[model samples]
Target: MEYEILGLPAWYYIAMVAKVLVVFVWVLLTVAYATYAERKIIGHMQVRLGPMRTGWHGLLQPIADGLKLFFKEEIIPAEASTFAFLVAPLIALVPAFISFAVIPFGTTITVMGCKIPLQIAAYADKSGGVIDVNVGVLYILALSSLGVYGIVLAGWSSNSKYSLLGGLRASAQMISYELAAGLALITVFMVSGTLSLQQIVADQAGFGWYAWRNPFLFGAFIIFFICSLAEINRTPFDLPEAETELVSGFCTEYSSMKYAMFFMAEYANMITVCAITVTLFLGGWHGPFTDAFPLLSPLYFIAKVYSLIFLCMWIRATYPRYRYDQLMGLGWKFFLPITLVLIVGNGLWISVIGAGNWLGSLFA
Candidate 1:
């Protein structure tokens, strides 16, 4: 039985608040340092010191940058749509953070005679079993797709030709790649037989097959990650904000904290992409020694997430922007067909292996 307080379980409220605080702060800090890390990593790759003056090898740069942006003057284009211009940033930002609510960051933890899941949206049932948001995958997809609206609004509201073009490009890119990303995850859903992200991680245990070992999952992982980069407008797929072309794309007309919000949204989405990749493609929170020392689970999860984040940074440092035609061609002419092939091949493989076998679960 659960203890009730104000018609809700005490654990319920406590868990809810705790989950919000922990996940929010964790994601915020990660986004902050990710900027710093990117600057330093890319700087070093180019044989230069990144930010030596901002406190010991630029350790305080993110904070300093935040402070600078906070204190900076605000500006709205005289010709811009005031209401939409202001609302655009909030729209883009809220989804990036709120989507994490369904992410299973770690397995579980025991404290004060209760087991609390690390995911923000999950709750415990009467029997104390964990209950997660059943539509975690769809929730993420919906929120992610919603964010593109803000981009479009920002561009259109700005009343700038460049911003409008950038916004249009972002929407187009999102449409093209979002399908590939969703199709890739269909394989994951087929294999896991559940939309709950926590259950998907649970299913990947002991196999490590999802990461790279199993051919079908490995294919899905590759497509998913590639599409994720495109979805987030990362370089090699970043035609929307091609600096030389659109003067920073959809954000060209914004300045100060408003722009900072968009900046933060991009990194936050990057973190989100990395987290979901870890949860779906990699065995999340299940690294060695986590079984014995459950506390190690989140650490393992964080490590894997950062590793993927580092890869993103590395790719950004190295890759050139793709041309608009090239981007569309790659998505339609290439990725779409490949995803379909993977799905059909996965079905055939599962049929041959038989669902009773562990390998057959790739499409079950």
Candidate 2:
């Protein structure tokens, strides 16, 4: 049997390992700081100082928080299932981190007369990302759907009424919103004619970004954003963790680093959703000078993601939490119908004008 990848020597595995390490470290750092950014931004929005004492305006607040959690006493409920309770956070957290594997962060760069992808993996000469699978969208959807299990298990295993209710609400909420979110993205797949996220980004290169190029997709983008908020349990849709009611919801029984894992998972999911949004609607890594200087692509991508994250924070500060019924209504009643209409309308429009041709027909 021959052992090779893309006809490269076995030593290539070493490079792949190094790339994975880099991405994992990068994502961890980003997730940590995203929490700090959220608190600071929301504090300022409410006319209050946020995290001012930790390190020069709380620059090192994430680090301090991490250390605090690390040293905290671990607690497990006497009545909880020993194993499932212990592993629930890992199940929740790992999926959020892995979802970023398929996201295209930047373009390829030439180094020493050889092309190197900014992401961990590449498909021959086509696209750069970590494992550019044919069903990239499906992969993400599957992993995201799996994240609900951790919450459900945590809630059920805890034997607490509040935790169980929180878990049930989370599962129902996520399932409802996932349908709308998937339907919203169907328009993008219909137009792009492929499930590969990197290809979707490639289709939007130059001035052909979907959000501006197709008017219908702008609606889809909005739908996606709303559903994403519900999916991530952000403010205005945070029924599962309603402090006034559920007492921290499904994680009521968790403490120490296990609790921190759930917290990190939430922020990590936020980062993943923001990155996916940038890739799908805002044109991942596409910007002025991106083509001329490939190194600038990542900068553009990260800036756009940060902007979206700030918007999420702003909404958190501005809006009160929705009642549970209202949250479910928004997903099932509003976003579902809207996304279905947009999907059908987009499909018909694409069928009429053809993929990547709508832009030219508008000016014609």
Candidate 3:
């Protein structure tokens, strides 16, 4: 069958390009400002001013930081492998940025009488987001896993003992937490009965947000959040880069824009995680009057994501870093068992309630 969109032959590839550019620019801007916000927030928490000298309330801090990094001296360790060392940052950075493509930012809008989705890619059935692949969840999982390669390569290529140790720690930490994170998502898959993120979001529209709708899902959310923090090597779980110990971890030998790439990648991953959390547990882009005002959909999504980002910063400011052993134990001894039990319990609950079939048909 010849596919059609808005009564015309579907030129989805063309539309896809346009959407990608818009989302790319939007994500870049968001990453830049997220850094600024984090510093400002942390400063206030500690009762100190942040970036006041750069612009009013440090409004220009991210730009200034970018410029400084751009102009900084590029340093390659004397013992480092030049090729791998140079490529490591790009490997770390690309996945984080591309993952956002599959994330649904908003609903559809009619532009010049052509119905266009706010998301860059949409499914054949017109669900929003980029590259509406049936296995979007798996795609995200695979891409996220790929980011570790950069860290590992950075450590090995740098020929620094400190970087090597930090990289090893990161690899171990990511593996431990990623299992729990993946398991937590399995519960979501079982409940929603689809791997398509846009479809998952659609299932949670209005009052059906899984975070509160299913008690088990709330537990999954907690597990996912904790595991995500560990996976991203954030505060309390940032063992790989323990400043006092690893001397800046896997990136110890990185300098200039190479260092900046890794930095940007971290923030990008943060935004990606927040976006995914909002899509799966929260209502994606659903909000009050969203049906009437389609533009409000992206706004709602951004608001939810930023709120979660603030929570991340709050935790960063409030908590101390976890001891290496404690971090491992929490992932394996604690979170693993909890998530395994929740998965079984959730599966049984869905079966008992016949939600499995119901959800399948509802979204199908």
Candidate 4:
């Protein structure tokens, strides 16, 4: 039983576990504040004050929310597949968190005489391997896409019509948007000449982000952002749980912790998409002159990611819900075609310009 983490001694297993624990805690805390940030931003958008009572402009609102959900009566439907119902949320959430393990957060640094890459466990000789997978973008897409299963299962296992319909809607919504998202990501890979997220970030090291690469990338960014909203089931694209129509959608019959699991999964997915956007398009932990002053890189990366998250919250607060058909039409008729053409155009443009070599040199 000699399990090692990143080729380190087996004793580092405890440190790996501790590392994951810390990330879990961070995700929980981030989700809590994301709710708060959404409220405050939306409140201001609607010309009203946001949560200000709990703790200094409502910092403790998430805590209040946790207490509320905790004390709420637990309800399990008599006809539900009780075991599957209970398992769905965990299935949905764990993968969302685990995918982050492969995403490199920052450059390697010497900490306490140990070299550390701001990433979690990677396979030994991580270069171009599963741990530091060259197909990171695809891996993220695959993992995030799998999240739909948990929702679908929860809805089916609930044995309720509303829940079932909600699940179906979610399945369709995620599937459609994932197509556009995949195409958009392909455009990034085309322009950057790599599928590895770390390499993508590395590519953006000197030159500005892919978002600044050109107007085409801006279009891709728009498509990616919109698709992410649908993928994460956020407002405007939140037809699955449209309170007026579906009565809380798939989790209508879910209660207590089950409901909380769905809630947590939503936020976790949000973070995942945000992280993906940062890594793929905005440049993961790269910054100006980072090779000279490496410390600022991670800060810049965090700033960009949080800013993107803030923008998501802003959109949630400002926009009204879309009609279900409108959501689908946007994905199919509009984003899909545009992304397809853009990806093709990107490939053509890259070929003409010699596969990012010219761009890289010019930027360098």
Candidate 5:
């Protein structure tokens, strides 16, 4: 017997396709401009000028950069594993795009009298969302863990010492810090009692639950943020690609679009992480007048996400790279232990008082 494909109507497919196109384009544009934002932000912080000639105030710099990379000659090393080398960039970039599938950008909107959620996975209603899954947090974590393999493959396939070392460093760093980051999010899971990101945002409808409503979670938030920095290989924890040491690390032999894909994956991951942070820590899509004006949800979400991204850039500009030993030590000794302790404390708090007691007005 043949299946009827979930018995869904044609309209559902059309609407889903529309949402996919919109989200994909938006994410791609955001990933491109994030590089520009970082350069400009750090430039101002360092009292120097960033790209100013590409367009008016460097507005088109990312576009120029993308085009330049697109048309560049593709080169493959003679001794490289041809298939894996080519596939690595795809592995790196695909996760960054697909992870957005589960992220909720805004609350429900009425389109043709049908309530549609801003999440790519499912439509949101009061009961929950209509997405493919209820566990968005886990979905993100899984996709994030998968992205590192591309780096490892790139390094290993290139058959270069620098690339191999970078891949090794990336694998180790991911294992070291991902634990603390995962544990830190336990605070959110415990308080929210669900792994659905959309639901987590719904629960944080106050002055941001992790920000003010629950003061204890703030510490874990910092730990989570630091761990995220390591996961994304940002400046201070960028040992995997430390230019001074590894000569471009995993992408040492990669050039043209392959090299570009690495950076694209990085920025896209940045956006994904910041979006997760907003959903779990900050009140997502909930700002002034959000109650009265549901249309403002996307704007609020975007504002909060960019604010977090800006904070990441600030940290990048201000902090110096940590020694490899110090990096491992911080992850293992400091962050891991602290996250465990915070989990225990949050468990106790939840058992005794409950989150709603902290800010009774926040629950949806």
Candidate 6:
């Protein structure tokens, strides 16, 4: 069959490349609009207009910002390691882009007598499945952990004391949240009994979402959500990039495209976390009546993910930032122990009786 690339006509590679280009362009555009969406949403919360002068309430704001950054002078400190400084952002941004390749954007469709799956790589393809590996959850955890390295390298290479401090703080923060995040994931693995994201989603098809199954697992999901924010350096846990303290934190020494790379990584990470949340706790691409109409499943999933993203932006605008000490205390003193207890409790409940009976006992 022409399904295999080597057996296909010469135009097959062109078609593959074209598809990639389309997705890449879409992601780039989505990143631009995400900035505008954040500003507009935050502005409403703060009772101030944001970027009105630039193209119809800041619609073109991202374009302007991109152009400005593009034309801006690229600065390198005399004492800094220029190579590492220049390379760090690419290292950060590439993984963010690559991570999306495994994401099942949509299901299979028949076109011109060929069955093509909507994903960039079909799960059946060994190479693409490496991207969509059975160990997807672990891949995400590992990649996200790698994100910290870019910030660290950027800070150390900048040769600035403030940048170095911000990097150190980021390292500590990522480590702390990573524990809660991983533990919360262990709960998911226990419930679904699979390390594969696809299998997890499949397990939720008829049975309702694990998030609503029991209080313990639900609590773990909440803890996971909050810790994910801290891991991504979002507000309330944004100590590393505390502008008043660290002068834009680890990226303080970066300019132009280098600075943009950090923002790209941040937003992309946000999307990834939200998608994973939907996949693990919210039953993934499953929704009411989705099986009856498979084509609509991905849309439902995307909507839910974006809604969560919007909520995060709203919280960022409405709430005051927490003190650094308070941030650490909440993560360590409260969330850590709570999540630990929940995991243990959930395990005992599941083992004593099946998950369904445990749920009935709790509410009955």
Please tell me which predicted candidate would have the highest TM-score against the true structure: 1
Q: For candidate 5, lDDT tens digit of each residue in 82-173?
A: 99999999999999889999888887777665667778888544454455468888999999999988998999999999999999998899
- The alpha-carbon root-mean-square deviation between model 3 and the true structure, to one decimal in Å, is 4.0
**Who is ahead in lDDT, 4 or 6?**
4
How large is the C-alpha RMSD of every model relative to the true structure? 2.6, 2.9, 4.0, 3.2, 3.1, 3.6
**Candidate 1 to truth, TM:** 0.95
Please list all clashing residue pairs in model 4, or write none if there are none.
none
Q: What TM-score against the true fold does each predicted structure earn?
A: 0.95, 0.93, 0.92, 0.90, 0.94, 0.89
Candidate 2 regions with alpha-carbon error over 4 angstroms: 1-7, 125-131, 357-364
Writing each residue's lDDT as its tens digit, candidate 3 over 117-234 gives 6666573443433346678789889999999999999989999999999999998999889999999998888878899887888887765777765667889998898899999999
Which clashing pairs does model 6 show?
none
Q: lDDT for model 3, on a 0 to 1 scale?
A: 0.86
In order, candidate lDDTs are 0.87, 0.85, 0.86, 0.80, 0.86, 0.78
Off by over 4 Å in 3: 1-14, 123-131, 353-364
Residue-level error in angstroms, candidate 1, position 164: 0.7
Error of 2 at 58 (Å): 1.1
Scanning candidate 3 in windows of ten residues, the lowest lDDT window is 123-132
Model 6 bad stretches (over 4 Å): 1-3, 6-23, 124-132, 356-364
lDDT of 6 by residue, 1-364 (tens): 4445575544346545655776577677777887889998888878898889887777889999889988899899999999989998887787777766655555444455444444554433433332246677887888888888888888889999988998888888888889888988888888888776666776666546788777788998898999999998888788888988889888999998889889988888788788778888887777777756767876877787888889779878877777877878888888888888998998997887556524434554
TM-score of 2: 0.93
Task: Encode model 4's per-residue lDDT on 116-223: one tens digit a residue.
Answer: 455664432324232357777777888987899888988899999999999999999999999998888887877777777766776776656787676678789888
lDDT of 2 by residue, 1-364 (tens): 3357767644346555756887788789988998999889988888999999988999999999999999999988898998999889999999999987788788877654445666664534424243467788898899999999999999998889999999999999999999999999998887888888878888887667777656678899989988998998888899999999999999998888999999999998998999998988998888988878998998998899989988898899999999988888888899999888998888777778666746645665
Q: If ranked by TM-score, best first, what sequence of candidates would result?
A: 1, 5, 2, 3, 4, 6
CA lDDT, candidate 4, residue 84: 88
For each of the candidates, give the backbone clash count: 0, 0, 2, 0, 1, 0
Candidate achieving the largest lDDT: 1
- lDDT tens digits, residues 125-233, model 1? 7687788988899999999999998899999999999999999999999989999999989877767789998888877776454655347767989999999999999
